[model samples]
Target: MSSLLDLHPMTRRSLLGGLAATGALVVLHPFAARAASNQAHLRLMETTDIHVNLMPYDYYADKPNDTLGLSRTASLIDGIRAEATNSMLIDNGDLLQGSPMGDYMAYKKGMKAGDLHPVMKAMNVLGYDCGTLGNHEFNYGLDFMFNTLAAAKHPIVCANLTKGQLASDPKNDELFFKPFVIIEKKIKDGAGHESPVKVGFIGFVPPQIMVWDAKNLEGKAQTRDIVEAARAWVPVMKEQGADIVIALSHSGIDAKGPSEKMENASLYLAGVEGIDAIFTGHQHLVFPGPKTWDGMQGVDAVKGTLMGKPAVMAGFWGSHMGLIDLLLEKDGKSWKIVDFTSEARPIYHRDEAKKIIADTKDKPEVVAAVQEEHEATLAYVRTPVGKTSAPLYSYFALVADDPSVQIVSNAQLWYIKDMLKETQYKDYPVLSAAAPFKAGGRGGADYYTDVPAGDIAIKNVSDLYLYPNTVQAVLITGAQVKNWLEMSAGMFNQIKPGSKDADLLNLDFPSYNYDVIDGVTYEIDLSEPAKYDKDGKEANPQANRIKNLSFNGKPIDPQQKFVVVTNNYRAGGGGKFPEIAGDKVIFVGPDTNRDVIVRYIISQGTINPSADGNWRFAALPGTTAVFQTGPKGRPFASKVIGAKIEDAGDGTEGFAKYRLIL
Candidate 1:
């Protein structure tokens, strides 16, 4: 092969100049001159499901974690901007709530009229162009949400979230935020010629927010279907001269196709005509990745396309930055996408030894913006409440009765019993239902709750109960209670007899939905199929997974009424559990579940949060099943209640594998 050095001096100079003009080498100007005059490259950057992680710190763990933080992602953003000619940064929501900092602002410091939220401050410093609302934004109620959003420098749009009743025509609905915003910007083509471009940004929140935050929403707010809203607004944006339209869908990709008010409607929303690309979140999973959404119909996992339209879902807590690079060519007077690439760029990665390695440093401006609140949050979460006789962790929550959940259940049961003392339903037997929120799943191996045995702090309590949900009690018959357990049993997959190492837990079922009801005894029969699917829809009507169900040493009576202590989310039909809805709600406490946990801990002075042998799996002789949990669980494997667990090996995504002998 002939080298450029072998060419004549004039020819070499000409070739180098041509290569520089084609952006093959570093350009001296902001926009590199291109070989073609009509071509331009526009990069759309997305940070979704940030959940107020402004710094590289974990409030619950009270330690520095390199895997998460918007400040780290901000550094990556700075580099991404330099790589593209024209770029826009946007958030796909779930930004307002997650970390202790968000709780500190909403429940402790309280957001004043003009005060900027820490998350908003960090985002503003990074110059966010636009953003959207996630379901968690409604966790603290409308007043708190609006007060926090008021301080944002950028416009926040939500097409589906309505102030009151949704109108018959989606376009006429009284939207809580503007349906969409069009940004008119000057884009420099590859030839360095500036041209006007209109990019429309529309946002959507899951309609299920009405169910999840019923106490905060209820009759006060309503929502239109995501695809329904997109169908109504995308065309209007095109007609209004939008050169490109992007959907900021705070929803996940569900291959089940579109249904009425589906929670994960991003897949269907992408099918809406006139939508050029999409930014997805709410599932806390990345798109264009090797796993997740693989082999799903109408989904191009490797290409990051849903229904043939480009899309990206950045990992939650600022783990990754979703990027979509579009190569646009002038088609008549409007720009059309001729080529594109989608990616979920991470700020950190694991090394060969499974240690988290920081890929970028924290952006100073982003960190400085939230430094005050971050310190205050650390102080607030570190306040000692009481002491625990045993450690609390959620590593094996899915496969065994866990102490992490037991503590929450104990707190809730105590709180509910006291509250019902003066109520007419005091005579009803009380049971507490709690789930493991921080189990190893989409949140990754390090997401599990691990509180050491000793003094319990507010952060430890928060880790035990991840949500800011208020305690609520639902009155239902014993039959309905059994049905609820059956619904929760959907977390497990059916295994065949004599099968070796069959998958035990259902990956599609979220750990937070695997409610473990205290004050009752039950055995899950893995030999039987799950009666209900992850969505709480009946999958096998003949299946009876809940076996040997009993209460107070006797079989539960079908006609007997009981008071089930749970969070507002569950009582309001957040998980679609059978017979557990608004009508069944008997009591709604004023304090949050975390507050109750703190109070309970204080009252105990020294508590023993041990998991009682309340629930277990029915033994299937000669059968073996396997499950994955945080690698940290290995130390406590023998302490797990129920089945005999043995170390299997290393699992995917940094999770440790355990085999269950049945």
Candidate 2:
């Protein structure tokens, strides 16, 4: 490794000047001795939003995945450490809750005090310097979270998360964890002067945690604003003899202006004074990329900087490892960042033939650290719960109301009816709202859920429902339900009334927002413009895309109220639908949606998977639209009702093209 003390910029410049003045060569021994003491390189390694992917094995699929897992990332970390003179590893949160392995650990294995969580054990084996908690860490409640954190060898910091109702006031609310940690690292300057650099790390989570995990957090804990927390803590860290400060922000970058409740506030957090560099995640996106930070002000995408300060966000699920290399120069008694570079290393990539292949070889030590948990998780997810009469897949979920979504709706309704019995809301009619989570967009063609007709295992339920969202009931008027459906209908591109073979299925619309509301029959008109824009703004006031909305055999009364059972994300304004969020919630169930599905399957013994044909596209003569989906859906394309679908050819990103005859 090249030491900073090997060469001094000024000494080398003076020597050249002296040589230029005199023809004869002149060497200054004193200048040469002081040359190597003036410069040093500091590397900051980060892993963000891992979501408990400790091993390469996918518990949900009951198979191995090359694209995910910290074991694979460990090899990359080892290689980087070998190349760098000085480096420190820090995880940027969301480490505890996403995969079925995490679910298995929390629900099945159960983490007791002093017990090591598989993720913590693996991270300990890898020797993490410090870590911060992401919003998902609170998904299993505080007790489980604290028990898991107890096993972590490194310090866990979170400045924003606090206890009690005084969360907004940081002074009054006691911090749930250490606000920040000052890590002392040794480095040599250009003059070969050795000194300790106190790198302060302060962490922040999204304030929206108070809303998303309301049931688990209410009256117990709350989260403060990210920017506000950083602004307050950075100054404190500076006063505590910290040479440099790094903001380990669990929030993502979304907007230029910072709000108290904004989910993506990393841009604003970076602007905080005294913060030298930043680590960002929670959007599951890559920074320093043209597509994500395109045209954004105060950002240098090529150099990976936010507000001219070094920053990086590794892709989620252990797909990438973020690295920030800082060129430090001594400023009197402390060190300041003179220059820096940031990049993320991926674990897998696609070849010319489009075959996904692993790049980083897995570290056996990391794999061995959690081998027992890995085997148990595999066993837990593979256990069969029930049998299905027909295949359950989501390839045609967005194009039509398929059996996959119908099963979710049926399970929610069945669970909610019993829970709401003998209550005041029991007298009102019940409805169910569900959306396809795996329709193959950014996740690629193989991401679609395809469960063959046979024994349904716990892993299949995890595949069916990717998120760990709890069930919640929202009470809304019939008019609001129609508005909700209209927002969902925006998934289709508007086609001219008589235009031939127009494009359908808006590529920008997320499949998770295209909800299918059960217990109501509706038809979407492709001829009209969308009522609302993708941001939920009223784009066209007079547009009427939703037609023939009826409940049972009669037309729905706009004033009549109905209770819709859906996941907490939808009920908490995740999709930004019209008049469906904020104060409309009537009940919040304690069980997760996955658990509900599991219980429903166990109760039924054998599930009859079939769509009720409650929704269809309105007739548009002489007009058609082309769509794309997974090629696996071609066999069942003819069996789907409401629209004519024909195989076209191969589509972009390994998907199959399909022509929707409207």
Candidate 3:
């Protein structure tokens, strides 16, 4: 149990002299000597939030993309492993869903018990050491999740996910999988001597999965809070023969303080004792980057350190790979991490012109593994679904209630209107809430959904709805409905009464969070401050952004009860929307929103891609707000009669500028 410096003086000198004779101790450095004899370097590599991107191609666009895919990341992994003598590759989940490939497998093909899911098949070829599930993994239901997990060549671990419902076993008493895994690796010490190192790897998923995927998980599985699960498992991992513990957290580092339902809780997991290093994801953000996390205690964003422990969160969709290098020193029979570094490796880098250049090439071997499935997926998505009478696009979704969002809401209301028959909620007026899934933000200009006017395919359907979330209806009061719309109004900037030109859309607010209630007529006054903040907190408590709210050509009563059709993510508190969660949920349907859209399109024979003009911006005299959108939207500018759209000029970041008279 002696430290490297605590070695007997005579023994140390003899060791140094022998090495000096062999020209192995050129500088006779104190730490270098200890490093050669007593230390081992362990490199931990991670790929997270991959979301079923196996190839370097965008299935939605049916084109190649250098910025995404696990095949490109495989090249980075090969290069990283070559630099380090000892390393382990792990995936932080959300890999089974997100793209057309995921839908092709889950909905179209349907996975059987023995079938190899494309994601797992690709991971098996890449040689993943182990992985943990993310919230999206449960999007398809428990049977599908386990069936896909069974195809993995490597072990799968999740400490937080468990079995049963909240009322019966809220504690998450029974684990759904092995809590943690102890890996025994033979590594070279500073002096080239080999030793067995016991590395403990544990994993955790956000507890909110129970709510986010309630339709899939409710009675079948439950989840414990990430921090609580870490507290219980880290000690058990230490009690075993584990020398060092690494957490593969399928959670993000939210600077926001601890919450039982915090979607991103990697920061809290790192503070738990006995955990040495951590790999994080699910926020789809890169850590150790320029973004500063202000109030998080013990978090060094620049150094990628949390609670003084090394941590990394790779950006989602295989855009970046997270790496943690650990310097371990042996103390008698155990090993302790003495030093470490963390960083994220991007697949592509943007030049001065903002053109993305591939930083890593696709690995041929990995591509060869998933080639069959990739071709099959492309074929599956290419199958024609129906025809659109007009173009289905989302270029102006943020500024106006466009066709892209309306079609989704139309389908939801159509489905729910029929579903409510004979049910208790049948008496209430049914409304639908839908949001634009793609509006060219972090996803770039090409991210917008732009299906042609003629034929529509399954891939087009995936572009319309990015997630696999099921349809859900929540019974809420009219007052609660106003608060909900107020939350959606947070997507706009507060325009001054006489301002000449101000930014209209709050780019920081994701377009997906800007829900447009289809059945209600309302106006969002940009001159007033947002009633809710971007995080859905009541930032301006007295501010009222929603105005002229009415239903069925009459002023709606605040005490009136209404059923609003929406996705599971929103109803289960994904956006933190007020009065839209918990017991407020009246019905949870098994059909995904995507399926609903498909059914609606088929039922109508030929769909009309037109907005109903249910919502608009309230006029503010002498003020105008400038916004940015794709140039393609210019042609459809006159179609929006609610707002005065003027072509301003060229905008930054390759967007076309437009001035909207509020």
Q: Using Cα atoms with residue i matched to residue i, what is each candidate's TM-score against the true structure?
A: 0.67, 0.69, 0.69
Tell me the deviation in Å of residue 583 in model 2.
Answer: 21
lDDT of 2 by residue, 1-662 (tens): 11111111122322332232233343322222233455567778899988788887767657787778998888776556644556799999998887778878887889899898989889999899999989889888999999999988899999888876655456455988899999998976555667899999998888767665666887898777788888777888999989889989988886556666667888888888999999998867677654657788877878899988999988777877788888777778788777777877666665566566666667888888889988888887787768999889988898887899999999999988877774688789999999999998888888888999989988898678877577889999999999999999989999988787688889888888999999999999988899998778899989998899999778999999999999877887878898778479887664568868977897898997788889999988777778778888889898786768888899888899988877
Indicate the worst ten consecutive residues by lDDT in candidate 3.
Answer: 1-10
Instruction: Give candidate 2 regions above 4 Å deviation.
Output: 1-36, 167-172, 190-193, 385-401, 409-455, 462-519, 523-547, 551-610, 616-662
Candidate 1 lDDT, tens digit per residue, 409-475? 9999988777677558878899999998998778898999998998878777767876656678999
Candidate 1 C-alpha error for residue 169, in Å: 1.2
Over 4 Å off, model 1: 1-35, 385-405, 410-455, 462-519, 522-553, 556-662
Candidate 2 lDDT (Cα, whole model)?
A: 0.81
Measured by lDDT, the strongest candidate is 1
Better of 1 and 3 by TM-score: 3
Clashes of each: 0, 12, 5
- Estimate, for each residue in 138-227, the C-alpha lDDT of model 3 and write its tens digit: 877888888999988888888877765433433336788898999998988887888999988898887766555666765777777788
